[model samples]
Target: MAGKRGGTAAKERLSRDVIVASALALADAEGLDALTIRRLATDHGVTPMALYWHFKDKDLLLDGVVERVLEGVEIPSYPAGSQPEWHVRLLDCFAALLNALNEHREVADLVHRRFLGSTAGLDIAEFAFAALQEGGFGRTERAEIGVQALHNLVVLVTMEPGERALRDSEEEVARRIREKKVVLQSLAPERYPNIIDCAESLVDKPADEGRYRGLGLDILIEGIRARAARQLAEPAEKAS
Candidate 1:
């Protein structure tokens, strides 16, 4: 019995939690793509076979990492604080997610790969459902539109390429706008009257981060409300 007990202890020397935790740390330090079972085994000073006991392959290991990353995401109760009164709450939630993603950029790359139907995602889905209902959307159709809006924002921000690489930096933002303004101004007046007319608006001065975020939030939300109102006014058959 003592020998059997010792054998069991040796068998359980490492755990899935330990492997996942180590993998998360490695991904945080290096990028997610850099995380390999062999590298993990080397990090833990264990043989590759030991890791296989925990994760069958890299994809499984990545699933574990995604779980770990989301475990840290705090989805607040719908009425937790001075939010939920309006669209700001939703924008704040998205901004918070972006901030979190920026802090742990390795997870940012993996954000699109997350299960959209997971428990965490369900909270977002449910949150939008409730918000739309409160905003006068009925229990039935509002939930669907709410989901569409949420997904639009998520996919838009997530799929937008090159936050780190190009077309998105302090200097680059200014440079691109300047270049665009120059190109628009050089166009023939009659050939591109619209671009020439709106050149100043197109290259408007950049707002600070807070104001910029607020403006974007305001535009999207107000635009959604306008669309909803327009749909409500149309004939039932014509609305679609």
Candidate 2:
């Protein structure tokens, strides 16, 4: 019966894309520790050799996962003669990336580390550099600003409140949040006034996740704009 089942599974048509998608779903639901070649073979009803044909090892398979996530980032574009402000375009680009990472935050760390190693990641970086150029930043400045912006966006998603509770049951997550809030509230107000004051926001999920993330993105864009202005001012100051 096992042999018959294995044969039937092998006949179901597995491909590289299929395996990557399955690995992504498995990691999102159960975390990366559960994503292994042998495990994928079992899920696909094939011998371990079948998966190995697609991905020689787990590290290469992780690369494929990062590529898949980055491919979801929609690089914003404008009409040739009707470009919006550079900050606006840049905001949209980073927002798209944030949305993608937020959807599959379990793999966010992987995306961060291998972000520039994939074609899609390069495409996003290219768009960002163009926007930074419009804002008067030179090559070195753009590289520094672009990398910092992407890094901060990833940090924002990974550090979002209640992110670690994603795999927990709703009831359990709620209970934990309640417990956390209670513990925070118990802190002496005189010593930790701010923590006590913001305890609910700290423990409970944000009421408006979009607004919360938007504020973070806004801060990043504003900082870039300020830096760009400062860069432009330096040459004039030196001339005087």
Candidate 3:
């Protein structure tokens, strides 16, 4: 029995990737506050020292989690000379990023802060930067747009309606949604007409989550497209 248990332990030897994957899963199921090295050690059936060997401290473990999330982004690629319009490619990039964040919404803020710190994050950024360049944004403009675009994508995930409701029982979620809709609709229509009209949408989950995210990406990409066009026209106007 002792030898059998020892062989099982040997097969389950810890690695950095395994530890980070476990940490991310824990963070997703529980909140980040519950993701402690001690808890991870307990989950892995090892001592805290085992986890510490992979992560020097909690901060490093958190960084590993951020890196793990960023690594999930699937940046689109096109064969040479066959790339679509810059806006289309840029939209695809942001969509991939949004999809990744949506999967692990609990770590959206952490990804926002530490995205550039990871190689995978940098790769995503490079894809965006290239698209922005093709769209005619200058160096300074690309820097600003890149930062703001990522921040807005993170906001889309973090502020998504009904995200928090997912943690509650179905009955509780339904009750809360009903209550919110009633409170919003109860407002004086004469002064709050729009609020009353949009009350249902405000309280209920979006019927199509993909469409909701796509709408946000469309708004972001259109704004960038408009700005890029204006920037391109500016030089011609100045020459005239």
Superposition TM-score, candidate 2 onto the true structure: 0.89
| TM-score against native, each model | 0.59, 0.89, 0.90
Q: After superposition, how far is residue 38 of candidate 3 from its true place, in Å?
A: 1.1
**How far in Å is the alpha carbon of 48 misplaced in model 1?**
2.7
Candidate 1 residue lDDT tens string, 47-102 = 77778877889888887776665556665555555565645555555555545554
Q: Return the TM-score for candidate 3, rounded to 2 decimals.
A: 0.90
Better of 2 and 3 by TM-score: 3
| Alpha-carbon lDDT of model 2 | 0.88
Off by over 4 Å in 2: 1-12
- Judge candidate 1 at residue 216 and give its lDDT: 54
Quote the lDDT for 95 in model 1. Answer: 58
Local accuracy of candidate 2 as per-residue lDDT tens digits, 118-230: 99999999999999999998899899888788889988888878535656778888888889989999999999999999999998777898998999999999999888889
**Between which residue pairs do clashes occur in model 1?**
none
Q: Which model scores highest in TM-score? A: 3
Worst 10 residues of 3 by lDDT: 3-12
Ranking by lDDT: 3, 2, 1
**List of clashing residue pairs for candidate 3:** none
